[model samples]
Target chain A: MTNFVQLILNLLIFPGGLFAVALGLFLMGIDRKIAARLQRRVGPPVYQPFIDLVKLTRKEMVVPGTAHLQAFWLAPLLGFAGMMAAVTLIPIAGVYQGFKYSGDLLVLLYLLALPAIALMIGGSASSSPFGAVGFSREMVMMMSYELPLLVVLVTIALKVGLATGGIATFSLSEIVQFQLENGALLFDYTMLPALLAFLVFIPGNMGVVPFDIPEAETEIVEGPILEYSGTGLALFKLMTSLKMIVVLGLAIALFFPTPLGKNFLVNLLWFFLKCLVLMVIAITIVRTSTGRVRMDQAFKFYLRYPTVLALISLVLTLLQR
Target chain B: MKKLLQKIAKKSPWLYRINAGSCNGCDVELATTACIPRYDVERLGCKYCGSPKHADIVLITGPLTARVKEKVLRLYDEIPDPKVTVAIGVCPISGGVFRDSYAISGPIDNFIPVDVNVPGCPPRPQAIIDGIVEAIKIWETRL
Candidate 1:
């Protein structure tokens, strides 16, 4: 039992954690490449992410004088762990059998929220007024985005229920199985509004583009992350990258399900393609767009409008039935 | 023994950057230098050190404004011996655009003896990395 427990921990922490980190790094590199191509500049190599993390880890960690060091330090770790847990829940290359029971959509939602909460708490504890202000804006962004997220979830759930004739299942595998049987959500005419909701949610979820107010560098000086340096800063960035991957992965799984391949290599390739396509769309928009939105304007646009779109999607699903 | 030490230091000089009172243009470029893969400072054994005490090369950005003068001096003083200070960007090298401002002072070398002067409003990331590489060469030659 002890050895088995150790093995389980190793599996969860090593390959599981390692896979998320590597994928996160790759996705960030791809984001940079896409952003560069959009701007007509030669981009950095893909290994740029690995180089950055290595350099940061070796650097000294600087704790601000005014910060509550305890909270500040713990926040990034919490955010990182939460993101890793979410990644583990989602099937990467194989069948959803690995963490199947643990992979509930609701849990993924809560885990997805953890990174943002960590940012808020960490920023608020930094004791910088700017950091405080950033936290305030982040909270508003969170509040605004939360409604549309829920609506999308419910709409997807409703579609699953409809497909199964009221046999409700929130498991990710069941949803994929439903897709495999009846075809992808992208092919469903009724899913067009949900697709719109998904599109809007992508930017909001990654905190990229016109929606990236929390850590707006030009206006807020990396916002909540202003006081962080060294390893703490690196961890925060790593978590952000991981969160980006999780958001894109979830988006792919929901909107576009590529059937799992017979072997690991084929499945992995398909998985990566889906992820890359989503990441390219996300980062391209980020690079081409000019940012800096007032807190109120951002909330008003994302929450009110997208919620209506989600409602339309739900109604359409019912109408199709 | 000392010659061998100098050789090692020259080959792998770890850098630390301090932002006294930057407009942040230089800092972003500085970060970009470390980030963009072509000038990947990490492959050269050069990295951004966390603190001055552990740093071999100190790359100072922005003009030394009134508020940060003492802090800058203290940080410069804290670095261990055989350290080289490189004034990065135009602001730190000549006080750049803020030279005439009352709140601003002269170049960073005015506060601490700077070994190199890398001049650009926000020097390209590659240039900064190259400047550090040059500073390491100086350390190997003289010390």
Candidate 2:
């Protein structure tokens, strides 16, 4: 009975629903502000995303005549729900231990793919030519990024498991627990390549400027989301913000989840601080500095660099074991 | 709650552009407002959205030439309701230099309800921004 209640709270309150939404929106707002500053311009307030969300919800929603209306409506909700649930899977090292499952890491791996799949579904369902182009590009981008992510997760799992005198572990809580007892993977020389690989994966998964070919507004006109308006667009916006939290939270969990102290508030602030630093380094800087790459080029680039970087860590970890 | 929504909604007006057959001059000016570091329209809580469907504010440029009249009207219709149209430059308002041309079809307000008019051959960035500010005020009442 308590477990059921706890699950509901976890999904709706902390780490997932309300909290994740707020933090994600803030991160996105900060990202935009910093990006504008980099361009030598004054930007909008950090609370601009929240204002945008409120604004979007109050506007009119338009459904295209040719669209698959049911799927079009369901797509954003599907992604929103998936990311909300996925948030509960992240173990906040010194705070929440995450869902206590031996294979939660594997489940998380699958959960991480949901938002992109939801995007592909939404894009194809819109039935616009731009949406079709977006769907194909999104599929290709998802395939390219997933390779490096898989290798990074596996390498971390093996690194932790071997040190603990076992085979590779697929449990995220166990990985964090292992790190807590010893030290963070950040300082470990062997895990550096995997960390770098994960850093490379962040922008691709977040669909930032360089990896935003699928939703290139100038060319594809926001692709799959082109036909969405008002409340529908609001939901997609919410989905992306929540996804920002999930992806950045996952990075914090994986590489450098060292909490400042035993106080819950202190630890939570530390976690957010680390997330901000990571976002600035990996996503904000890269996005601000680069233009969108061609789909083929992005595909080849992801396959070559991050995939190889992660594999190097995996092979080295194996040799150490 | 409705009043509160109206207040914030006014702050998040997203802009989209429709080029009726102008020389790229007006379009370039519109792009400057959207992109140039010196004239950051984003500071006004305005973003240039790619799709008409996602737009809350529409910025129409150029004289509505006869060939592009139907298509521009169709595009304008795609913007969900309660949208404000700001005609940028003299072309969209009076057909400007194209007024007497055989192919010219506007003064765009004749087809679509234009709420604000910024009239210059190509309106200055400051004038365009002022026009947008006026459009947002008009938009707030509808929201």
- In order, what lDDT does every prediction score? 0.74, 0.89
lDDT of 2 by residue, A98-194 (tens): 9889998888888888888888889999999999999999999999999999999999999998899899889888888888889999999999999
TM-score of chain A of 2: 0.99
Model 2 sits at an interface RMSD, in angstroms, of 0.9
Which 10 residues in a row give candidate 2 chain B its minimum summed lDDT? Answer: B29-38
| Highest-scoring model, TM-score | 2
Name model 2 segments beyond 4 Å from true.
Answer: B33-35
Screening candidate 2 with a backbone cut-off below 3 angstroms (N, C-alpha, C), the clashing residue pairs are none
DockQ of 2: 0.87
Native contacts kept, each candidate? 0.00, 0.91
**What TM-score, over all chains together, does every model reach?**
0.78, 0.99
Q: Native-vs-model 1 lDDT?
A: 0.74
For residues A182-249, write the lDDT of model 1, one tens digit per residue: 77899887788887787787787778768878877667766787666657777887898888767877
Question: Whole-model lDDT, candidate 2?
Answer: 0.89
Cα TM-score of candidate 2:
0.99
